[model samples]
Target: MTGGTPGPPWSWVWGAPGPPRATRRRGGGRGERPAGHSRPTPPASGPAHPPPLYQAAGRWGTPRAAVRVGLLCRFAPPQLPAWPTAMATVVAQRLSHLLPSWRQAHQEPQPSGQPEPVFTVDRTQVPPLFWKPYVYAGYRPLHQTWRFYFRTLFQQHNEAVNVWTHLLAALALLLRLAIFVRSVDFWGDPHALPLFLIVLASFTYLSLSALAHLLQAKSEFWHYNFFFLDYVGVAVYQFGSALAHFYYAIEPAWHAQVQTVFLPLAAFLAWLSCTGSCYNKYIQKPGLLGRTCQEVPSALAYALDISPVVHRILVSPDPTTDDPALLYHKCQVVFFLLAAAFFSAFVPERWFPGSCHIFGQGHQVFHVFLVLCTLAQLEAVALDFEARRPIYEPLHTRWPHNFSGLFLLTVGSSVLTAFLLSQLVRRKLDQKTQ
Candidate 1:
């Protein structure tokens, strides 16, 4: 009675609530029943109902899209003296919209539960540029962005664009390439234009890209050469893209046979392969990465020597844990093999169609392989991000700023998605032929 409910909890007190608070009374005393007698299912307690809001992925949050936007906001340049508090307020409110009725937004619990919920955070829901997908891929670290990026200001690092460019580009190019391949008439050149340019542009970009990095560090004179080459490579990409789609526009019916489509492409190869016709005046002979045949056609102009050096370095076997030089040597071997693959396929030969060029049947598979390789580079990027984490005074924070950590996990998930789709697509195509 002192606590308000004049009768005992099990006394069938229905709607007699002064306030809802924990009420306890000695269960053994004044029960008017003998000890050990099964307490008759202590009538009904509280409301015989569950709360209106349901538990999902642990703490209840508002709509998912709102959460992703909150994440993107975390990367904004350092706030002015008057803004951290202001920005904090706004971010908290935005997060509140996502937190379900069961949980408060932005308020992390004393100890978050295990098997955290991975939400579908949409960057668009938060603002002017809504389409960008900046979901928190992994766990947010227990620190701020400043604590994560380390740099005083949000300056883009060397590998910033390198990683995002491929990631963002992959979405668009992968789709385009897949469609172009599907549209092929098995013989027609017209519809297969995108693929043609994609290969050329990819090689040209890669060649110049590799050249740019390797020489940019050597000297300014060499730097200029590689820089110009990089630009020229971009120009080639533009041409390849347009030519791939419409080069044979004037002769639509000619694309009826896949061989006809690709044969003219073989001519284009002559253009790509013959690169080193001019001496570098500076770069040594046996040259770093190019061919020198002035007479060969455009299609066979470029060589594939440098890319292996880069691709192998990407997934280098752990140098610290593995035999230190073994990883480097393994990468070296992969590098040369990739280079050989490129040179053999792109380089001109007297054997022409009968040579190992016939072995280049898995170019489509290689495209997927490229995607996997890029993901590996991204994992390295995340490692870099993790390494830059800051030393805060154990701030009173809720969520951690483990962006890189979350990103690595997300990469794995994407790989799984890719594997499932790859198998399914292969099955469907294989079944159609039988």
Candidate 2:
């Protein structure tokens, strides 16, 4: 009893081992098992090593490099034949190191609610040769979302494209509209009524488009109605402006100038009626909606996961409506396309002859301007600099835009240069004041 002394407290017992068992730790000796009986590892004192990810054959960059290594490992001419197990162990060691780094890094807590560190993969990189889908497995819905978006040409996407396309178009038109409202257009044209009407229509369309985009995002009923209205407005302007082209008509005593406004406008309305009634169902569930359209989720991993606060700011809505007016800008686009078409199709003046028939006079200048506008529209579509969604990405997507800009600059400069040359040759002297 004296030798034994006092026993352990109440928690301890005479016969049993301790409550918390000791993990089996590896002893530093020959034929030792790894600690905790978890995973195995090569002798720790062997040498420094790269992570498993760094050693992956293909991971070293380029399939050829990996192929070269694998070929050497398996079929080398010399006596460098290593057992598969040994090779696998070495490779596994490297990957094991790499796995811990990123996993641990992401485990680091941040104010943002995300659990893992977002991979800031550059979007412009060689479009993930394979295995990209796994990257954004969490945001799979975004795949369907963007799919619904791009399929608009085939079917309506709750005003996704209609609202946004037109909104973007409006911004472009506003650029042109501003130019017109400024001295360049107002000073030169004595007949400002047409210009004013045209500009007003543009502004109205922009407002409608933006409203449609926002409201439609809220519900399907709103989406359908807003989309319908948007289509109507589009057709109206298309036909109205076409008729307005010949608006430089002699007013009759009885009617207000017999400008065949009804004809073109009616054509547009008829198109809407026919389209809405005939392809209503088809347009709603367009065949292309879930078709070949794919996002390759890894494509914009960085951009899509950007901070929400910055996103809110850049897409700032109008203070009046609390929306940044991304939707409103679309109306401007509708106006521009319709107006530009009208001008190109009808105007037959000395300064800006638009029609094909009005050949001899200064019609060439208008033709050139129309071409420039078309090119600008195409450029905007390709570049989408204003949208700038990439700013929110974990990584940047500026390269595609850089390429797009170069293409636009080249195309526009060439078109402008050609038109100017033609203008210089065809200057009807004082025909400019016409």
Candidate 3:
């Protein structure tokens, strides 16, 4: 009743102000309550008071304490403004239109699994282009995708063993080369050039053989191309073997005997071996004739390449000298002969045919034996290099030029031969299609 707002009439009795009375709106509209019930009035406006539990300031009775004790009701959610809600609705509608295309662009395509079935073909089912003489089963289907053929590397196909034998051999050779490099001064010593070339060639042939076996099932064109390159690898390895034997293992008297014509002849024979291999493949000759075409020149090349090793082993001052290098060389020769027998004779496979399809094939045996032969040859050559270092170091300064020149010549010619043969294969393929 004073100038300022008056207290409620019941304030003295209650010891606090009573709730404010609800007011009616100006218009007699929907703001009116029911006849017997009156709604509580809201505050005129400042900040809102917190809930009952949060009204206290002391820690023990606070809202946080209530929450920690699991006695608090749910918290009031934060209010989002209307403008942002409207904007979000608008953005959602806009983005909804793009959802399909966005999903397509961002989503990974599910694999179709078209070539999942990597079953092998029998000889009769095999395509003519992929035929082997005695290999009757386990031939992978022809004209598959490159990925499909590569996947067969893990699968059990005929060429699986062929692929892995050479692949593992390449890895083994690489590891050996790493160990061998530590012992020899490969870069500084000019005489180490032959050793380097031989190692490089070993890697080349092993890798190419693996790749050829792994990927040749792709198509006829790829088949010819890969095997042609494989022949080139063989040729390069042959020349490398010749260089190593000639430079490190030859007797002084034997070196004088073949020094003039040996390298040139070896180079020519390497090219010839590649030529024979490519031609044999190109002709698609079957049975023993086809194999003979492939193996004869390679045999001749091996004979020539190993002659120095043979002579050194035979003419060692004492047959029973326990010379480790000489022993390794003999082991190398033995492995090579066994490899040749398996390669040419087609042993158990020829005898049993399809029974040996995935496992006991001559080609796989040949690959393993050849790798052994190469390993033995490497050990022997390494020992010879160390033993003859003093004798050859003076002669090495002149030797590098000859060795590198011959190596380059051999590589260039082998590549040229492979290229020429591949072109011929392509031409023949074209002719057949026409």
Best by lDDT: 3
| Tens-digit lDDT track of model 1 for 222-286 | 33355445544533543343232222211222223332333234324422332222222123334
Candidates' C-alpha lDDT: 0.34, 0.34, 0.75
Clashes of each: 42, 23, 0
TM-score of every prediction relative to native: 0.21, 0.27, 0.71
Regions more than 4 Å wrong, model 3: 1-115, 287-292, 319-322, 394-401
In candidate 2, how many Å is residue 284 off?
A: 8.9
At residue 307, give the lDDT of candidate 3: 91
Which sections of candidate 1 miss by over 4 Å?
1-159, 166-175, 182-195, 206-215, 245-434
Q: What are the per-model C-alpha RMSD values against the true structure?
A: 30.5, 27.6, 11.7
Candidate 2: 10-residue stretch with minimal lDDT: 9-18
Model 3, 1-434: lDDT tens per residue?
A: 11223233222112233223321112112333344443333323311333343334234653235333222312223311244566789999999989988987887664676433655878687668887756777888876666677778788978898889889989998898889778878888667778888899999999999999898887788889999989999999999999899888887777768877888888888988998889888887766877777877887888889998888777788745646688889888999889988877778888886688788988899999999999998988898888877655554445424767888888898888888888888898899899
How displaced is residue 194 in candidate 3, in Å? 1.2
Ranking by lDDT: 3, 2, 1
